[model samples]
Every structure is written in structure tokens, then in C-alpha cells.
Target: MNIAQLSGRGVEITDPLREYVDEKLSRLDRFHDQITSARVTLTVRDVKNAARRNRVEVQINVPNGIIRAEESNADMYAAIDKASDVLERQLRKFKTKFLKQRHEAQPQPEPGPAEQAAQLGEEDGEVQPEIVRQKRFELRPMTPQDAVFQMEALGHDFYVFKNMGTDSCGVVYRRKDGHYGLIEPK
Candidate 1:
């Protein structure tokens, strides 16, 4: 597997720095060999408060999908280590889950498109209705001011609620530029 490390936000990027990152991320393949490549990015925050805001983000590419993990620390090396650790665990979890699902399906040998289509047509003779397997409980009657507070508390881009005074289903969402948008039933 190949590992590429890149530094952004005017940070110094050198071969030795990237080599260090590659060595840390390469350890993940010890647990899950299916990883094809990893891309790590380092960026320094422009905030004036503290150096802790510097961040490291890592992305691992697998056959099925990509996995991303990130962490911010006072030092760039610490941030990279923390993010790499999280990525390793996530890779193991995904690999185990995918193998278990494949084993349960007992899929047959690969076949040509014609044979596959015939099998699919036969299987489609039986129809099954889908059911809602999960239900999410969200929000409560509150003033718009309070609803906005709740939305930020949940760290979500949007929130749903019954406006206390209006007694109607409403939504408050965060915009890309840190603005709030309200949706009220007409």
C-alpha cells in the first residue's frame, strides 16, 4: 500500500516529514491488509488563540469505500499519531463487518450478465415490502431562540421542532456561511 502525506496552509512540507507520516500509517495494514492507499493532510489553523487548533486528517482507501479520520493537537506529530490510531481501529472494524456479511450471503460463483439477469428475474417473482426499522425522536416545543440553542448543542446542521407558541412543525438549519434558515409550515 502507498501512503501520501501533504501539508497545507503554508506549512513546511518536506520528504522527511511525509516519510514519517507514511511510516505511522503503514502500521494499519498490519491489522487489515485490504487497504490500498492512504492520504494524510496537515493544516495549520489561522485562529489566534492556540497552536492546539493545528489539525491532521487521514483518508484510507479500500476496495469498497474510503475511510476518513482526523484529530487536532498542540503538535503536528501528536495530531498525526492520534488521527492514524483512529484510522487503524476503523479499518479493522470495517474489514471484520464486510467479511461477516459476505460469509452470511453465501454468494455463488461469478456468472455472465445473461445468467445473472435470469437469476435476478426469478428472484424478483417474490415481492417484499420494506419496513421502517428505525425511528428518531427529535426536538420539543420551544421558542426560536431556544431551538437555535438546541441545534448548536447537538452539533447538527439542522434541527426539527414544534414551535411552542405557533404549535406547528418547523425546522431551523445552519447555512454553509454560519447563517440560520427557518422553515415554517404554510
Candidate 2:
């Protein structure tokens, strides 16, 4: 497991903390050996609620997707532990689905027209649904803060916009706890 990046925000990371984080994250390799890289961010926010001030965010890159978990607590160690637990569960779930897909029976050769008709006429056959609606809109480049405002103005749970800083696509969404979260490609 390559720890691609580890940084702190609004707080300096001490050697002990860094080592602790590395130890915790290294154990994740047992859950998903395909983890290509991992990025960790430790942040200390000056918020009124001390219990929600310290935050730990972990992003792990796998073969086809990224697994992310964020947790906050009064103590940074506690936050890291919670985030690691979340990542462990997500990785297990991902591995299960991946193995299921990999072990499924392979598709057979195309059936002849008569066989196709017979299969289609089966009484218990199921049909795939088609898209029922589509919409197109212009994506404006803006800051994440602006995107959050736009999302709220439109009464939407999420908004997508081009991040002006990185010049990349980003999404800002409202979390269940009323806080906003941003998603950007690495």
C-alpha cells in the first residue's frame, strides 16, 4: 500500500501522529490488497463544537474506483480510528462485489434468431428499463463555496461545477448532518 500523500490542515502533524496514521492505514492492506494508493488529510477546525473540530479524511484508490471515509471527533486519534473502521467495511463490501462479478459465469455466444425469439417469449422473462428522462445544462466554472450556494439556491442536494482553482470537475453536496462536502478527482 503506497501512501501517496499525507498532509495536515490548520495544524502541524507531529512525528508520532504521522507514524500512528501510517500504522493504522498500513493495516488496511489486509482488507483490499489492490489498493493502489492512499491519501490522508488531518484537519483541525476552529469550530464552536469541539467534538466535531478534529477531522480525518482518507481516500484510497482501488482498481476501478476510489473509497473514501471521513470522521471527526474531539481527539485526532479517535477520528482516525473511526475513519479506518469505515474504510475497512467499505473495502470488504467492494471486495465481495468484485469477487462475485469475477466468478460469475461468462456469456455464451450469440443465440440464433429462433432461440432469441423463444427466449423472449418466456412467460417469466424480465425486460431492462430505458431512460425515462434526460436534461442538459451548462456547467459554469466556480469556487466550491459558490457551488454550495448555487446548490442551495436551486434547492438541490448536490451541484456540479468546474473548479476554478484546479480547473477540474467538482461536486458539492449537502451531507446528512447539514454540513457540505466536496468531491473532486485526484
Candidate 3:
């Protein structure tokens, strides 16, 4: 498990406060033992729209996806409690979804020969020819950041290239929020 914290410029966290956070977050182990890693990031934000509100955002990223929990309260402890509960609920949801999908994993039947032949032909009784075109591109090894930039320059949302760091082919893409995301082979 990994934990990182970055509070806002004006926010201050004492050593005791940090310890308290660790204690509460450590309880996540009780819910998921197979959780390979838990990344906890704490951030503080000031709402220009609402000055009186307290804003604390906690983001947890595990193997499947990211679970974000944000809360605002007059008291910091209350905010933390609410955020923890949000995370717990999100994890529970993920657990339930995974089990449900696993139970529904069944193989589909292949198309019959008659249907396949009709699909390969056209309505006018014309047989489509195979081997339309062939093309190839050179792959360059680079870091994830460089690959993402290349993808943007090429007007593509995603790009595949060799990862110089891990010696594996990886995919880099731009997220909807204008942020970068990456996928690496296990």
C-alpha cells in the first residue's frame, strides 16, 4: 500500500493528525485482504464559489479503478468520517459488481456456416474479395509522457508504443478531463 498527501498551501497537518489519518485508513485492510495496493491522496481545495464551506478530498486508487470521496463540514473530523464512509461504500460496490460479473461469464455460440457465408457476400450476389490493404508503422521506445504527447500531436486519443522503462508495449491516452492515463501489460 502507498499513501501520499498534499494539502493546500494554507492547510497545516501536525504529526499527530497524520498518525490519526493513517490509523483510520489502515482499517481498509479489514474489508479487502487481496487488495494489492492502496494509494491514499489527500488534497485541500478552496471553493471560490463558497467561501464558508470546508473542502477536503480523499482519493483512493486500487487495482480496478479509482474511488474518490470528498466531503465538507465545519469540523475536519466530521469531514474525514464522511469521506471514509464514502470510500467504504465505493469499495463495497466494486466488490458486488465483480462477483456479479463473474457469475455471468458464459461463452457465446459462433455463427453458423449459412449465416457466415451470407454475411461475407452482398445483397446483389457479389462475393467480397479479401486482402484489401496492408500498412505498417514504426514504433519508437519512449516514456509514457512522451507517448501521450505524440498521440496528441497526431490527433489521436490513444497511442501504443514500446515502454522504455519496463520493456513492454504500453498504451497512453488522454482522459476526458485533459489529464493523461496509461495502461501497461502485466
By summed lDDT, the worst window of 10 consecutive residues in model 1 runs over: 111-120
Best by TM-score: 2
Question: Each prediction's TM-score against the native?
Answer: 0.54, 0.57, 0.48
Q: Tens digits of per-residue lDDT for model 2 on 1-186?
A: 678999999889899999999988888899889998889999998886544589998988776455778899889999999998888887887777667756976423221221122322355547776799996655776667657755654457878887777787777777767887776666
Query: Candidate 1, residues 1-186: lDDT per residue as tens digits?
Result: 587536566477777778778788878878778777777778877667755477887777665445778798878888888988887777776777667756775433222221122322244547785886865654466555445655554346767777775677677777556777666665
lDDT of 3: 0.59
lDDT score, candidate 1? 0.67
Model 2 ranges off by over 4 Å: 49-52, 106-186
* Model 3 stretches astray by more than 4 angstroms: 6-8, 34-52, 106-186
* Candidate 3: residue 51 lDDT (0-100): 51
lDDT-based ranking, best first?
A: 2, 1, 3
Q: State the lDDT at 108 in candidate 1.
A: 34
Error of 3 at 32 (Å): 2.4
* Candidate-wise lDDT, in order: 0.67, 0.76, 0.59
C-alpha lDDT of residue 67 in model 1: 73
**Candidate 2 TM-score over all chains jointly:** 0.57
| Candidate 3 residue lDDT tens string, 1-186 | 245653543457777666766677677766655465444434455667765455557666444334567778766666777777776776676666546755874423222221122222346547666788885654666666556645653457777777776777777766657876676655
